[model samples]
Target chain A: MTIATFPPEPPPPPSWTRYLGFSTDAKVIGIQYIVTAFFFFLIGGLLAMVIRGELITPAADLVDRSVYNGIYTMHGTIMLFLFIFPVLNGLNNLLIPTMIGAPDMAFPRLNTAAFWLVPVFGTLLIASFFVPGGPATAGWWSYPPVSIQNPLGHLINGESMWILAVALSGISSIMGAVNFVTTILRMRAPGMGFFRMPVFCWTALAAQSLQLIGLPALTGGAVMLLMDLSFGTSFYRPEGGGDPVLYQHFFWFYSHPAVYVIILPVFGIFSELFPVYSRKPLFGYVYVAVASFIIVGLGLIVWVHHFFSSGVPQWMRDLFMATTMLIAVPTGVKVFAWLGTLWGGKLRLTTPMLFCIGGLVNFVFAGITGVMLATVPIDIHVSNTYFVVGHFHYVIYGAAVMGIFAAVYHWFPKFTGRMPYEGLGKLHCLLTFVGANLNFLPMHPLGLMGMPRRVSSYDPEFAFWNVIASLGAFLLGVSIIPFLLNMLSSWIRGPRATHNPWDAIGLEWLLPSPPPEDNFGEEVPTVISRPYGYGSGEPLVEHQAEIERRLQLQEAAA
Target chain B: MTSTTPLAGSAPASPEAAHGHANHNLTGFIIFLCSESVIFLAFFSGYAILRTSALDWLPPGVEGLEWRTPLVNTAVLISSSGTMVLAEQFKAREKLWLFRGFWLLTMAMGGYFLVGQAVEWSGLAFGFSSGTFGGTFYLLTGFHGLHVATGILLMAIMLVKSFIPGNYTGGEQGVQATSLFWHFVDVIWIILFLLLYVWR
Candidate 1:
């Protein structure tokens, strides 16, 4: 059979205009997603700084209460919807097809449509700040009654716009789920069975499946909320005998699993990086892979834990509490698998490795607190307090964001065809680790002291911790500079990346960095073994020697 | 797990199946329909909860919905599903004219169902803000009607594409996707019918 038909030399890189325009290429779409998401990340970070600035002292001096509400609301909405979700999707678009040795995604046009919806919904979301009511003062959870209130009586108030934007975002994500699930299931390279697939692909499948089943609840709820707010439905309007708590059920049903939808890919990132950095095969590969689906299953039922303080029935609270804690078993399986992978191996403390280790440390902490919060009593005690804030930030920022940074650093070579500056990457990781811990750790004590979250001002007793947290927030803000600089300079004039810079064992590593326009071209490499054969020297793909020879020849010709 | 047969494991994408790509598209489409159905489930659940909990479920003046038009509308919509199946079967057999006739008939039935819904909406005694029951009634039925309209639009597009001479004869995946979507809309209506009309 025909195999290893590498082009004589690499074609010139595609024009920069492709990034701005509608390009169906998965790589372009991936870059577009990443860069756009980072832009919103910066915007969200700025809003966060504003929030921390207001809370620095025990007074509401920097921004007024209404403005503070808008800032924090926008901050959460932008960060979760625009940054974390899109960035992971960008990685999926770039990696899934390449990892499976497909030419491109199964539904390339659908993928493009999904990416474009991000900016549309993002713009509409941010535009809510410009509207009369000053942008969705309700929390990111957007619980009803509060979300349904519109004193301004404007046709397109902030809450309405926010609901519309969120619903549109849900539609975009559902489309993305369809595309990713289809591509993963149907487009694997020859011999890449479900078991032989990389753990990342497994995580992606699990995450997208959650998206398919759970996201529509949120979208439907948002639409009903908008109808109540604008079109005069009583879905959540208690004045008209509507039930607000049912809205809570709908919101948390998706929003709670949404936390997993965001973090599962990060878990996959940890699973991917730990083996490569430690020079070992992933310990308990099948279990780590299977654990993701387990997490998805439990993720669905455990959403009611978010409602323990919202006055759910005691039986529901008990049932959800059990399911919530049970999720930790699968998660712990992954954690132990990573630890086992790292144990007694030649370790590389590269930038990605540092971030992975840091993220793992933070995830373990988050997982403990997650179980704590799952207990109905503890959740009731810390409900709507800064402690809950601390716990999730540990998951969202301390773990997930840090994991995302690790992925960027690890894949920078493959994305841009140039190696990221190691020193700058390390600096970014160090500052981020220090800044995140400082910013979030104080909140735990403040929460235990009964200090509530999402407030502009607090009592004088909370002042000391607030000051330290604000300073940490500013440091976290500064942490972005090194990352932007590294990505910019590396792409411009950093050392040219070899085909497999880290000697990684995946289908993506076999191709040249920033792989060709049509990935794998005519001869799609049939995966022969599992990807994490690190020191075992087991071949990953058939015709390995021929493929390597052709790769070298093409590189030399270029 | 360490090793796998290269060729046999990837048989789905092999060159053997005559409709391999079409099958993948249908798989993706069916999955989309499944996801879409959950949105309707959310609406249905909301209606059920509101209906059961409210002391006075109906509005002041109106006793309840008149089920006659909707029953006929439901029959019209359900019959379209049968026509849709015939259209797809004809396309598979390469009988282009028969496919077009049945496809057009299905679209006409879908349009008729939508018209019937609009008439029923217009005849309703209560506004959308009447109460929890009225709000849910309009929201659920209106949402379902919107889906029916979308399905008709999709079928219209496929019908237009059929005029391209050899579209269906060459095998059109879009036709199957649209039909699947049409059937999904019908299934949602069945549930909505039970909750909104028959259950009372």
Candidate 2:
């Protein structure tokens, strides 16, 4: 039988403008996520400053207690939902198909639908602030009775809206998760084996799978809470004979793994960037991959650690604490591997590298604090204090936020056809680093001093540390200026970037700086060698030829 | 191109091209039906958890609503699944009129099940807002009815498309997917019926 080979099809015309409302191009969808997430990040940051400002003096009276609660609630909500998940998934949606050498996501229409849902859900969440009783004061955790009994508005609809918005966001994540999994599983180019795939792709796959299983529990918890509040259904009402602790169990089942859901992709980002800046292959490829899977596996079991003070059984507490601490082993392996990758290699010290290095430094402190929290006696003292707040800030702002910035700087060339100002970029990184530590570091001492969280003001004895923290917050606000300047300046008139400006080895860098509507031009890649296999020194064409030959030989044998 | 060649190392098949003619529509319908399965699974889990944990719950008070009527509806839904299978068989054989007839019969049976659900709902003493039991019960069954209604709508669309010339190019695949969806709906209803009426 003669196999017919057709000529390559012409590239699709740029319908970006016309199809703006309905386009499924991963690049455009990614841009939408990046821009919208940045907006929310700014809003969330402003809320943080308000919180810090209010706490600067003992009995300062900057904002009332109710207003203070709203500030912190919105801060956590915006950071988790609006900023972290969208930014990570947005980067994945934009880059994964291109990186894996596919035309688009496995389900492109569904991908588009998922992206649109973010803004809708985000708008609803933000709009709840204007409701009669105000945004949910139940904290981001929104624990029951407090969450359920709060008068949300005239119709008590704020909590309902919160549940509905969260459910909508869950739906979006589920759809995106399904698309990422299917695309990575079935739609890879001919020779892109699972092991040969990029670390970011691996992380994306793991995170999305986590989302698929994890989200349903949250949705279940949210629905039960909504029912309890709206219709007097006793899912969590103790008066009606429902146990509130059951709500905690169901909620943490998803929420605990959700911490990994936020941080794992950030790990993926570092996995990609550390090698590029260090000019070496990732030190332990298989180890890092296995570690990510272990994190996901371990993440589900350790959620009870969040409820250590709730009087759970001692054996369960010990089990959870042990699992939580054991998680640090794999996490430690990743950190050491990253440091090893950076060792003995010529470092670039670019904007991305600065953030990557900054992330490593901060992650060390965060991990140490995490280990401290793992001990039950210590956690019981600091569970709701500034200590817990400081620890998470070190993880989220220190590790995850820095990793996100690293990604933005690394991939901005691919997204925009222009390079960000490297000098300004470095400045942003430095100020953000110093300002972040200054802002969060003192909170440890404050927490140790028995200063609780979510309070508008503090006692006079703790006023000195609060002043230092507020100063850092103000400096942190200034630090973002250079980033805004760099982004706006670069977007307007920055130097045009080459397709592969950094001599990157990935398939994404092989395309145009700003890829065409359909992603590829003439060549549809079938990979043979690993993406970052730098030591072999074989030209990419030789690898391509080898892949083709293998494919053809397999065809003949069959 | 021959079927004997085996589909190995070929240019990647477009999802649409792989399910050609009769199979294309069936695959699309089945894929959608799988998505619906996830939705119902969520509802079922919620219902089961609520039922076991109900405090001081009463058996629902509804007149003329012994387990017998839902049992009969269960049989009707199960038979509709069989008819849906036969419809796909006719479709595969290119028996257009028989395909249309069975498709309509399946939709009509689905409609009858919905009517039975309405009668069941009308007889309930407690509504969705009454308590945890009522909330879970109504939400579970209500979501299932929505799926049945959607399936009926899809079948009606297929029924109309069967008569239009040049409309049924993707042969058995589309109908196969639709049948999978219909069967899924049927199976879920059976599970719900047994759990709600007979399990206790």
Candidate 3:
């Protein structure tokens, strides 16, 4: 049998300009999602620094009250909607199809269309600031009455634009969800059954399921709010006998599960990375994969817990609290599975692994807080405080962003066809771990001390920890400079990566780094064996020969 | 788990299934409808709240409307589902002209329902902005109306594609997808009809 060939080196890589325009190719689209999402990350990071800077003292020094609201609102909105979610989507776009052994996404043009909506809405959201109302100052949640109370909600223009931006983004995400679900379900390579697929694919499927079922509720809420503000419709207007709480019910229905939409995909990244770095098959692989689906299912029901403080009747709160707390079971299965994978293995300690390990460490704490907060008593205590903020950031920034960084470090070689500088990557990882803890860890105490979040300033009594958190936030911010430098400097000058630099066994690693257009070149991969198969195998022997042949070809050419 | 043999577990579609179209278009379309139902659920929840909690189903300045015509329109919309099923069957049988005729007939029924809804709305004294009743009524029904319009437009596109020689040969996928959406809209109308007109 003829073996598939890998080119000696990536020949004359595609121009950087492919990143600039419309491309139906999934890789091209993936890059677009990543770069654009990173830009939004920077925007959100700058806003975070401004927030931390303002909170360093009691007074709202940097920006006034309304403006501070906009700043934080934009910070949260950009991070949640624009940055983290799309980055996950981008990573999925880049890797899932390749991992599944499909030529590209099920609907390539639809994928491209979904990607284009990001920029349009991201720009719309950012542009809302320059508009008369100065961006959705009502907060990302845009709790009605407060959101609809101000004509600024209508006339000031920012909240209106925010609603439009969010609604449009929901449409974009729905399109993407349809594509991802269809791709994973229908397009697996021959022999790659559902159970045999990688854990990452399973997580992607679960997240997409949440997106499919959950997002339209947000769309429904946004459409109602839009009409309420724009056409003077009363879907949320109490004077018109409308119930604002109903709107909250609709928004959180999507937004809470949406909390998972951002993280579950990253969780998959952690699952995939741990096994690769540990040189072990994902422990209890079926359990870990099923755990993700469980998270998805539990995620949908627990959204009501966000409103415990909103005067939910006793039975409703109890029901949601039970459901919310139940999520920890599946979550525990994953954490244990991760730990189990790490046990009894030759650990590589790569930068990617470091972030995953660190992220997992933080995730445990976050999960602890998650369970605590799921209780009605504890949640009501910190519901409006920075304690809640600390807990959330621990997961969102600490866990999810850490997973993103790990995925970035892990995939950077494949993406850029070059090795990132190890020293700088390690530095980046260390500073980020310290900074994430420093920035978010202290907020728990501040909130416990009655320092409500979204305040432009806090009392002087809370000043000390705020300073520490601010400094940590700055450290976190500074950590990215090294990452950007590492990627930029390496993409141009870094040594060309071998096909499987980490000796990982996955379908994607079989292809040359920075795979050619159309992904597998010509012949489609027929997947065999269990996912993450590590031992002696036909494909393994063939792949080793191909890599050696390519190395020898490069040697001969030189 | 069928981990040992790939062929048995894998989708039986060869590349000859034509440009990867058969992989999951029908399945994707169905899943999309399920999600769409959730969207309608949000509206239904709001409608249910308005129905039970609100003091009046017909708020101030919104007089009651005759239900007779809307009932007929509901029947018209539901019958379209029947035609849609026929379209799916004809396309699968490769009865091209029969499929086209039924497909157009389905589109016409959808159009008729939309117009019936429009006439009902015009006959009412309330507007979208009137009050909670008017707002929810117009919004929910309007949302459903837009979906019906979208389903018709999709079917219209299919009708055009059906006339082309190579398109329908791809199977009744186009027919199936359109029928799925068309029927889903019809199903939503039953709910909308129940809460909006019948309960009122």
Candidate 4:
């Protein structure tokens, strides 16, 4: 494969203002998404703290009952929609083009438009808090009858506002999924076949595919629900002969796959980080990549597991239980691949690696508990208990959020042209790991003891575990301090970073730190090797001399 | 830049490169349509479940929907798909006027279907709040109607762009995408018509 030896046009000077404006550059949009999502993460975290404060005692003293419902509802909604999804989209925007050797996304203007929808919907979601009836208290699922109840008797009530925000966000994500899938399918450099691409790209492909296939169901369901609530329709209103169970079918059909949509990228992060730190080729690289799609296929069918106790027939529940259990096989494949990669290798316990290991360990725990929750009998017993809460927090916070931290630390160098402070990063990881466990672990027993979820108060016996969980929740809240400080300080004045500082073997590492506006410049590199090629002397790009020339130019510029 | 690509047509810019760019756009648009189809599937499933299970499928007093108007509307929409195909064919043959003629006709047929639906709704005793049947019928058809309106809007834009000198001389990718969307809208209406009127 020939690499063009043409002189590259210099990228424009970096400026902070572009991140604040309507910059179509994927890198700028990526940072904008991450920073904006982080702001919402803080808000969601504050709501969690309020929930924790109310639960610290056996009495609902910290907030009123309705306020507690609103707080918990907003907590779930904001965490999933606002914080997790947007932050992951941010990562997708940043990593996809660079990893695949593309100049930019296939639809750059559409990418910027998708990023802008975040703040618009974010404002709408937050505005619900100021609305007359407070935020929607029907839980984030927003099931009907409860959701259709308009106690405020106003047109612009909180529930409608929540649905509007969610629908708008769904539209944004659909636009993003279309862009991501097209880019991944058509924009890879010459010689970079699908098999040769990094695991992260494969995972992003699978996740966005889930988005394209599953998100529309939720959006359509929301529209019907909106019509039922506002326009006197009965799509989900039982009083008008509309079945509420039908809404569950629509909601869980997407929301279940949506869990995979969140975790698959984190799984990609785990797959990415383990090999880099262990200084070895990724174990069963093909299997790891293929397992992602397997997860996606199984993910779509297992959505019925969420409806086990929603008056579904026994045959349906039994069938769904089997499908839900089948997901564990592919997940087990990924977990073992990470372990095998780490086996008998020169392990560098860097902060990113530490977070990856922590996240992986927690993921395994979540998987076991998930399997427990998958069984029809067990699920019915702890259907709406804190056990379900514990299981997902382990998945969402324990695995996904920790994995996000690892990615931020790992890519901080490449994105910001500076190395994150290892000291603060380790402290953040430690606090996060411990706090996450303390916060989520007690819920297992409290749930086994039959404590229900979404309640502000509990019985005296449940009070012990609740207090400990609240303490852990507070610690988890405090864990963000070191992380924010680390990011701000490192980006502002940390030691400057060199391209390929970690000696990573992806296409992104072959370019200058933060790359350029046209990520690969005019002549994108033709990848010649599989990723995670640690200790493999084979070059990743075909024309090694051209990459060396580009590096020399970068060094000279620096 | 080769001139052999069908849609690239005679252009000052490179046709070969534009062909690949246009393919990416079309592939993405098709993927988007696939997602859009799932939304219709959701509503269809909802309708099926309620029709089978609910006691008041047609409600107590209201009569079932009349088949005559929607049958005609369905014919109008299905013919619009054929016209859309002809529009693309004449564009490929470099007959710009025939392309615009068929394109505008296809849009006109779509517009007529909308008018027919409004008239049918006006005559029906059932309102949106009548029952589950009323909710599902209106939601499904109204959703499909929205797609039809969007397709017409897109076709109208393409038709306008064709009038500008040198615009469709290069053969607009928007023409192809718009026609694909129109055909998709037509197909969805066919399924929707059968489900709403003929199924019972």
Error of 2 at B198 (Å): 4.1
* Residue A82 of model 2, lDDT score: 84
lDDT of 2 by residue, A266-380 (tens): 8999999888888888889888988888998988889888889987889988999999999999999999889888889778899999998998899999999999998999999
The fnat of each candidate, in order, is: 0.58, 0.17, 0.65, 0.68
Model 3 spans with C-alpha error above 4 angstroms: A1-11, A152-156, A535-558, B1-23, B61-63
- The candidate, 1 or 2, that scores higher on DockQ is 1
Off by over 4 Å in 2: A1-21, A150-153, A540-558, B1-55, B59-66, B161-195
- Report lDDT (Cα) of residue A225, candidate 1: 86
TM-score for all models, in order of appearance: 0.96, 0.87, 0.94, 0.96
Each model's DockQ score: 0.36, 0.17, 0.38, 0.41
Point out the higher-scoring one by DockQ: 1 or 4: 4
**Relative to the unseen true structure, what is the C-alpha lDDT of residue B29 in candidate 3, on a scale of 0 to 100?**
84
Error of 1 at B36 (Å): 0.3
- Among all candidates shown, the one with the greatest DockQ: 4
Give the lDDT of residue B132 in candidate 1.
90
Query: Per-residue lDDT tens digits of candidate 3, residues A130-232?
Result: 9876777788899888887555444648888898889888888989999999999888876788987888899999999999999999999898988887788
Looking at model 4, give its docking quality level.
Answer: acceptable
Each prediction's number of clashing residue pairs: 0, 17, 2, 0
